[model samples]
Target: MTTLPTQLQHDLQALAGEGGYRDATERDVTEMRGRYRGGSTLVLRPKTTEIAAAIVSRCAEAQLPIIPIGGATGLVAGHIASENQTGVLLSTERLVNIREINSTDRQLVAEAGVILANVQAAATAKDLLFPLSLAAEGSCTIGGNLSTNAGGVQVLRYGNTRDLVLGVEAIMPNGEILNGLSPLRKNNTGYDIKNLLIGAEGTLGLITAASLKLYPSIKDSCTALCPVASPAAALALLSQLQHELGEFISAFELISGQGLHFLREHFPQLPQAISPPPEWSVVLELGSSAENELKKLAESALTKAIQKDLILDAVISQSETQRQQIWSLREHIPLANKKVGAIVSFDISLPLSKLALFIKTAVPKVQDFDGNLRINCFGHVGDGNLHFNVFPPIDKLACNYRSQQTEIRSAVYDLVQKMGGSFSAEHGVGRDKVSELLQYGDPTKLEVMASIKKALDPNGIFNPGAVIDPRK
Candidate 1:
């Protein structure tokens, strides 16, 4: 619980001006998906890192909990605040700025509030690539990406958000600014503090800015939509294709027939590249910086795959427009499903070898709760991460099956644990999964995590109830 000092609030308002703060309504503290609800006394949108630091210092003195928010697009409910606390919703929207773009170093220094798409566009303007991408790139902020250590389409090749970040400048709970923005590729002087804050989900600190690594813009590329017999076949094709294409393989997404069905029903605008969907579909992309015979190589590799019966059918994107269109279908599935109603979304990772079995075992357990339950499994199969989503059944009686959430989650998470996988993969263990994490995570690991939390945030003033309980 937190109690705000009226004098401190007035001082902060004076420093940031009248427009910098707002009294957070009940609506402001609730999550975007409405799965998690919270309340806060005020929402502060500081325009600069100094202001943020000052706000943090004031809150620390007052012992108030500060919940940092970006675009609020996270699946883990990481941005929610508690009602008992005088929760200060610290937003970085005003801090959005592309501070510098060094073409020579192929690096961009950006404020945390900059949208992921804007950063990509900035890199593109410099003939460089910021390859971290997802459906929420337009809305999800760079800070949120760093906080979650986001993994998206290009995780197979470019790696997760943690890989792209070269340095981070964050404000620790004690109001000390940890400045580590070095664009140098090699730094072995000491411990890597940047990584600690990268996926801490605002528990350790509030990320203000980052120096991000960039890649040479891909000049040649090929995309294909293929129909496969099953997830196993898709994995096999991925392995064979990767062995042949090597580093050229950028994105390989596996989509189930039911996932495709949702896209077709909700998003009629997207073109279906393959007819009469097989049990599974794959959207694969290959890219290269220097111009090469990419199309020929892709076609030949795909031809070999088809001949081997690894792929049932395939459609290659002839042009850039076609590639984007194919990607739209893959990206729009989540948004399309949201229009209908709520969903229990799981972002889990299993070993590539065990993905097929994990999906097979989990689907039946979910269906046993409601036979007509809509299970849409799709994600970066190359990275062994899948977005396993369960939508409510069409039948009203069937839709009222909330009681099965625990059983279904346990079944899926248990399989993930058995396979040496993470129940919370790309998504951090926010309040929503704290209990599950306590149950599944190693006790020793949790102890170390708690020790670190105590070391950095002794007062527990930063994003309470996130990642781990400070009170514990």
Candidate 2:
């Protein structure tokens, strides 16, 4: 199954030529979650979109699957192809280019392979901001971010990756280039194909380049880590802060006591904002164009919340160093989770009104399912997205609890469904979540999606097992 007919590899190599062909590396064949392993296949790194289109065209003629491997930083198993699947792994890493930065128009264009942090740096160079951010920004590429329509810390204010994209230029299933990277905000001439590809997770097409929207750089900001008695108390404080700070509130994260414990156990020397971490706390950040204005507003809001008995203790950042220290606690929680290991992790979102209720009901239920399990509940609370991960007791290993993963997921996901929440939030439904998507996904919507897949990929040559399986 790993064989690509020898001649096909040679043909692909000739098509890619010289610098385009690269030997398979350990990282390329493995996914982030350790769920899927890629098969031995030709890895083609096209330097230009034309070469990419030609490669796709060649694959289409032979009715071969094409997997567009973006940054390999995807949480879900989207990029990895199994042994039975035969095709070329097309990489856009060599397609790194900051095509244009229109300062006057407040937009930038970049190829798919550029790392997200590099794009942010380019925008910063122009005195602008690209608000899409995630923990893996340093490694994840812009194409991967757009493919998943990733939501990060600033989603509470700037919206998800799709909202930040003006347009995208992609290669359709037939290897034809769809030039939709328009700088204009308003264009209603045809079908909204740009959107279809944005969150399609590369099932419909391979996104090559994008025109992105940018925001004005913030000159000042205020950050604070305050303890809340419970999720409900955090919700109350969130409302009060929104009323006081309005759109300036950039990020609002909920941190759990166990997360702090994990950090202390692993990274004891790391600077922490709250010592002997409270049972529940929230990190709130506000950004503005004005100089030294948001701090007083944040202070006034925190004071009112404390008086109202919503906040237990407030520690506002005094300097830029202090601000980073406070954020360090929030940013490193996932790394800590990785070290401690999780039995099962859920990336879910609920209605703002149901956030508190869902957490209150879920904690006991999950713990009751496995008495020894510990929960780490936190995420971008302002946007209603939560990364609720379950871990084993200090002495227990996650592998030992593998038998209960199904039950644990059912316990949490069923409740999420009842609350009208999503089982998959920021992370797109990759190979890992296909079953859940079918179980929880709407039937009518699924049918339409299947039809779309069939229409675009008539030969079923574009990512055979991704997003939607080949329609009958």
Candidate 3:
């Protein structure tokens, strides 16, 4: 169904120059995470948007599928090439560039290949802030963030990548450039085209660059690790803090005692604040422009909560080193779990009030598979998002517990559905969750998405088997 002509290959090689393209070796076919593997005929890395466009246009003429890859950090197998199709892998690694940082407009225009951390650093250099902070910021690209509409620790205050984007420039399936990179605060345009491509996951188009919104850097900040009784108590404390601190409450992350236990057992180098961990812990952060009175405000707020029994105990970070240590504990849970063994990670969201009930019902069902099965629960409680991961059991009896993955997933998802929650919250449904999407996604919404995909990419050459399959 796909063809790669000799002339087009020569032209691509000429345009990209030496060492820009490679024949897909057996190792390259295997994915970075070892979850999804595919055989790609060619891996093409274009240094500029022009070269990428030319390669894409030639492929369009030849009817060859093009898979756009950026950092390959996505949890879902969204970037895996199909075995049935002859595809050209478009790696955006060569397109790494921060074109401009306009301080006047508080906008940072960066190529899709630029890593999220690099973009944040560029913004920080100008005394500005790009508040899209994720665990994978070190390796994930801006284009991947834009494509996935990534939600991270700062989503409570700054919002997701979708909210932070000012505009986007992408290459359509027909190899036409859709340049909509305007840093306007308000625009009554005919249609918001940037929104379409922001979360399309390279299914509709290849995101080339983005104009991102930046914020004024915070001069004063306060960080606290507080122990709570339960999820309800955590939510109650968050409500009280929001009432007191208002917009200064930048991030409020939740972690279970089990999650903390994992860190203590696995990451022994990280210091534990509480000797006997409470049922739940809340990592609260406040950012402000005024530096003089931040500590007093934070201490006073914690004192009030402590008196009311909302928080059992608290530890405030006194220095930047201490703050980083506390954060490292929160950020390294996923990696710690990975080192231990395989896990079934879920990014689910539920109603703030029903979070405790959902967890109460789901945790036991997951543990029923194996008693020693580690349930590492942690996420942004302010937005009701939880990264509920189930680690493989350590005992011989639980060796084949992976066979019950389907039952475990069903139990968790059923509880979420009963609570009127989304199965896939921040993470988009890639090929891994297509069946779940079809089961839980609204029929009318799915129909509209199918129609849009059909309209944009009739040939279905762009990232097939991603969010929606055309054949279905």
| Best model per TM-score | 2
User: What is the full ranking by TM-score, best candidate first?
Assistant: 2, 1, 3
lDDT per residue for candidate 2 within 160-215, as digits (tens), equals 99999999999999999999888898988879998999888878889999999989
Among all candidates shown, the one with the greatest lDDT: 2
Pairs of colliding residues, candidate 3? none
By lDDT rank, best first, the candidates go 2, 1, 3
Displacement of residue 412 (Cα, Å) in model 3 is 1.3
TM, every model: 0.96, 0.98, 0.95
lDDT value for model 3: 0.84
Evaluate model 2: give its lDDT.
Answer: 0.88
Cα lDDT tens digits for candidate 1, 1-472: 3656778778777756657887776546677666777776677898889888988888888787889999888877788876675767888888899999998888899999999999999999999999999999999999999999999899999999999999999999998898988788889989899999999999998999999999999999999999988899999999999899999999999888877777777887778777665569899999999997889998999999999999987889999899998898889877866765544778899989899998888898888877888888988888999889888876553247678777788888887898899888788888889988888989999899999998998888888888896557
C-alpha local distance difference test of each model: 0.86, 0.88, 0.84
lDDT of 1 at 437: 82
Counting only residues 3 or more apart in sequence or on different chains, how many pairs clash (N, Cα, C under 3 Å) in candidate 2? 0
Q: What lDDT does candidate 3 reach at residue 280?
A: 90
lDDT of 1 at 177: 94
